[model samples]
Target: MGDTEPRLDRGEALAATGVGCFLWVPATGQLILDPVGRDALDLLPGEYRGLAEDLRPKILRDDWTLLSGLSAALRGGLKDAYSAYFRVALHDGRSRWTHVRGNVVRDGSDGVTRVVGVVRDATLDLSPSSLRPPADEDSDHLHTLGEAAIALARAMSVREVGAVLGDELCLRRLGVKAMSLAVLEQGRLRLVRSVLSLDDAEPPQKSRLADSWPLNDVVRSARPLFFTSVPDFLDRYPRLAPHQHGFHATAAAFLPLVEQGQPLGAMGMFYENTNSFSLADHTLMTAWSRAVARALHRVTMLDRSREIAAGLQNAMLPRRIPETPGGRITVRYRTARQGVRVGGDWYDAVTLPDGGVGVAIGDVQGHDTEAAALMGQLRVAMTAYAAEGHPCEWVLAKASAFLAELGADRFATCQYLRIALATGAVHAANAGHPLPLLRRTDGTVDRLELAGGPPLGLPADWDLTPYSPTSARLDPGETLLLYSDGLVERPGEDIDRGLARLSAAFSAGPADLEELADHLLDTLTPGPHAEDDAALLMLRRDAA
Candidate 1:
């Protein structure tokens, strides 16, 4: 080789050849070789060598493709530039593993040139018997287990981690006939995940296991336990004898799924053919279980926090309607039946400056903390407006404008009603809500007619029509009812049906304000677990 060209020295050539077979090429599709390794290059057949030669030009043109091909050729054993490998089978029917590791070279001026690396043959079996006793195999298994643990820890859910562990470690590789993860719920073991062999003719399935099994024992003791054979396990614990016939063989292992000293569950691995679980396997599985347990605990805590928050939001709503003179008022509220969907449903009854009571009800657009907070803000704003003696239409318009200005657009629906005690007149304005029902002392019931407007949070330029409040003379024994939509609506029931039910309940009895309020709530919507928050308010005119 010329002095201008880079070349591998004697030791360098041997080190490269010893680790793996390597080939390097310049940007111009030329092979650059050191003197010592020229003889070894002749060993490859012309066809194979031609293929190698063809790679030089492509590699020079596309560095990423070149590096990826090199890495793939080396079976992922090679790392870093200046090193690469290719496994080749000789004409004599022998195969060899090779490793290549090296670095890339860049011209300081251009910052783009060619790769430079070493190739070496790294073919070693390193099986348990061939390697040093005890420590080597133990370390290898431990390393594998650590990788599995890291994988499990990155998983998003407990079920995901369980699937990965059950499939990758226990089922395919370990020759286990079956594997399962059982969670300890209220002191009893509940099967959460299971993997069974499809080839079995008469596979026995175990239901929820008792608390006295060896798996629970391991969890209670916070340790790992192994049984070399099924008979031995059964002999030690007779409770397992009845379940032994279903398993292919008696060998089993139990690892405690624990997190921060608290036992959450247990994982069990079973082998049909008898074999003892090595200490390394036990240790690795224990670590895997601990990771899974931590994930489970996190999910459980989040679910509980949501439940408590929902309860708190529900408690913030008024439990009873305020008493108003001249007319009767009753209200009901329901939350969504789905888990943790607590949201912003609010109703308020305030004594207006003119002695006419203002009744307002609204629902925010979301089922979360933001919705609840916005609801509280709107409720307070409405109360302020009512105290200022704003008419129902003006109160709604101002409130809607305020919400829009505050950037609460597209978030809420509200209905406000002003009832004058002296005149027996009910003035109402609606901003996208179900109309209230008015039941006369006679057999007839009517839907109070009111003009509808856009819900709060729309742009200020949006139309704000003054709603014409409807008026009706309150009969001596008649009742006026205001309610949130949840009262009569259910998943499969018709809206008209729900309204009819409400009307019938009101007319069924000539009840007083308190009795009517309770009757409407208890008959129409009752339960601590209402799917949506319901608010009901009723006012009755006393008989002369």
Candidate 2:
């Protein structure tokens, strides 16, 4: 009887403050709510002691959907505490905004056993703004946060993530006046983006991590720092007094971007009208920071992966083309713009045993690491066969057999040719490769028609037709071009038309082989979003 009197007094005290407590046990599906909580949820005194499911009909359907995930977040052990703003339907046929802030009690295995929290009526706190409707302002604010998260998830680079955060529309949606993001690199903070309203003045692009700036302090401590006013910020960090004009905000919040227990960087948000952050605002900002951190980590990993792929691809290509005394030889290799930046397009200029220059250009079946590996092996085999004094046709045949023997379930298109340095004589063979362009001394370009066989790696019985050889002569001041299909393939376009365009460009190109190679790339290459690898090899016999 003595304990009951103290409990009653405590409940009365909580009711007077308009804050009510709730205890929920997930295992037994039991819920207990105090008088204030029951009144806010529109539940009768007797109805408050029932199961949690019995109160579902009192919540707005969309709000229930939004708040229901809190349980999963606790059960999965992903979050220890959460704050949610949702709508509840009252018996008077009207909706009231309710705010709940709770902490989970986890058992030994980290499963949520119980939840203890406070509930309050939040309808009066939903302020009207130009960006949202008055009736569902809180819901619209949450929608804006969801949109930002979706945009961040698709961001491919750190700069892209900053762009999403700094977009003016996104800022307006979230009622923020300005935003900034910085990344940590080698003990320094490199500012990625900043959208301040100050004219002709902004913070430095880079700062030492040990500096006394709010961003640096937040990163070092892995905590959030909020300033309610300019004076408050200056009082805490007096060293930044000189740069106060650059911020120009009444309030600001700096959050650390930490992933996997490592501090990656920090994000800063400035507000004009806000004098202080409410509990709801603080919770939302913290959650948003976590989403931004995850996105930054993901993009950084992708950047590293692309770098590694590009390095491997460059290492496999020829470091230098053999100096051909007969004529000038120029080559260029470009990675795809849209994907992994690695592919199987390769070019080789090998000095043959008979003092002739042997050149081969080929593209493997795919644009992945396995294709690149296969291309390396095939190039080595072809170069070796040419050095052993094999004919152009025989070299292609041996390459095909080598690819088939690997059982890689892939194929490649190749063009191999041997040219006599002194005589300008050419013997060429093709395997499902594009036709080479021959430019006459008069600057007229025409495709050299040649018999072709299937691409390499075909079954022995499938390639009964031999790879036939074609003979051609290179005259003085004339060029012969070999290129990958990427140079002529376009989406929603005909390859023949692209080939015709290339022929025109080649005919009008400069006499210098090096300059001509550049001309072809500058004129014939696709836009920045080209999705296939391209390789080019050009040889021009010296004028007699």
Candidate 3:
């Protein structure tokens, strides 16, 4: 009691108790202040003062327990904690904004310590200030737009660029309620990407305003529009009244995604509650839209480039059959339908110096430009080796070695067949390929089974010897069919079933090689779409 004997005055008593500047009065349920000036305390509005009075009793009884209760109440509701400014609006017409600091102070008698904290009245300066200069917000907007443009430029496809733009607008800290990107396809706007909520939450509902909202107006006019309030905007454009319900009832801005007077699409930002979009927000969004347009253009160019490259690669494959003396050889090659359209399936036939013909069919491991280029190299090498009069096995062995060296362990499947017109014999060697079909004139089919060899490009340590050449007589009225796996195989279908189907289709069809090849290409491939590339090479012997 000797330490500045407790004063009778509520304020002085709080000060003497050394419980910091603010003390909760249990009896009156109000905060009794000490030496801190009234200006700091005066920052609280009357309603919040009443709230402090109501909360004082709970705080004095439980201390920090009351803080947890308050935080739980404000979790996802309208509450904000920015820098040092924390504000929360209670159900009652009361709002609280506080500046707090704390430290540990020891109790003199027990030599034990407790944390002593102070809640100061620093609310007077809590209002948000405009840090953006007159046009500074515009500059910031341009900067963000530049970032979006760069992302789009670096994107490999249109869908990729669309993803980048959607993420930027929908994943940033601005709490954007919804966003979308549309492309002008065949004179109609097609939605490419749609994103909702800048926060990690379910996306809010959205409507396409391209037909009746201000977005369509902006896009059609190639101008940007900012709406501070939805009610007023809806009054002017009553047709959009129905779509303005829900979260779209809040303030918004529409910016046309355009470049060089051509409109690619539009970008929009929606809020949850009624408020006006600032001029800075509009400028920033407009710049972002422009950047997005540039990105879309770049993506378009990349798609065109890929298409041209794919077309050129397709042309690199053989177009027509090369006329040979004993029989006819027809080739068909289809490229992959999706992803990189580089076709790895290839077929080649060259007349040898020794009056024999060399034929090769192969498939590389991937569907990309690299795979197509490797196929080209292998085709040329096989033709050159076969024209040199090397035996079929020797050609494949040397080619396999060359591929192993060139590919550094990359692998491919190939089957090479050499036909000697003078001897009426066909010699073939297969490297991990399906057995070729021999169609006899009597509607009988035979599979020319050769011992399997290691795929081309396997290391030399592997047993390449297992793939020795097999020989068969090329009797009159027989057709030899060699093809890539895509011809008779499909997902979920057994390989035996595919082979049986191919054999039946060939046996049931006309004897014309062209007709048979067409039937196989048309009926053997599943569905209307070819999931993978298919290559076919047919060689027939003249009827005696």
Q: Give the best candidate by TM-score.
A: 2
Clashing pairs in 2: none
Worst 10 residues of 2 by lDDT: 127-136
Clash counts for the predictions, in order: 50, 0, 0
What Cα-based lDDT does every candidate model obtain? 0.59, 0.78, 0.62
**Model 3 pairs in collision:** none
Q: Candidate 2: lDDT over CA atoms?
A: 0.78
Q: Which runs of model 1 end up more than 4 angstroms from their true locations?
A: 1-303, 311-330, 442-444, 491-494, 505-531
lDDT winner, 1 or 2:
2
Model 3 lDDT per residue over 284-306, tens place:
66656666778787667667766
Off by over 4 Å in 3: 1-306, 319-321, 526-528
Alpha-carbon TM-score of each model against the true structure: 0.44, 0.63, 0.46
TM-score of 3: 0.46
lDDT by residue (tens digit), candidate 1, 1-544: 6678777687765755453233442222234444333323224333334223433322222112213333322211233243333333444544343344555443324322234555433345311223222323766655655665555554434444455554322233333445677666666665555443323321222333344666667767787778886567767777545544444555677778777777777787765544756656566556655666777676555456656766766666655556666655655555553346667888888878788788888888877777777787787887789779887878888888777766755458888887777677777888888887777767467777678777877776656555455555666766667676777765544576567667766665444667667667655553223455566666666655
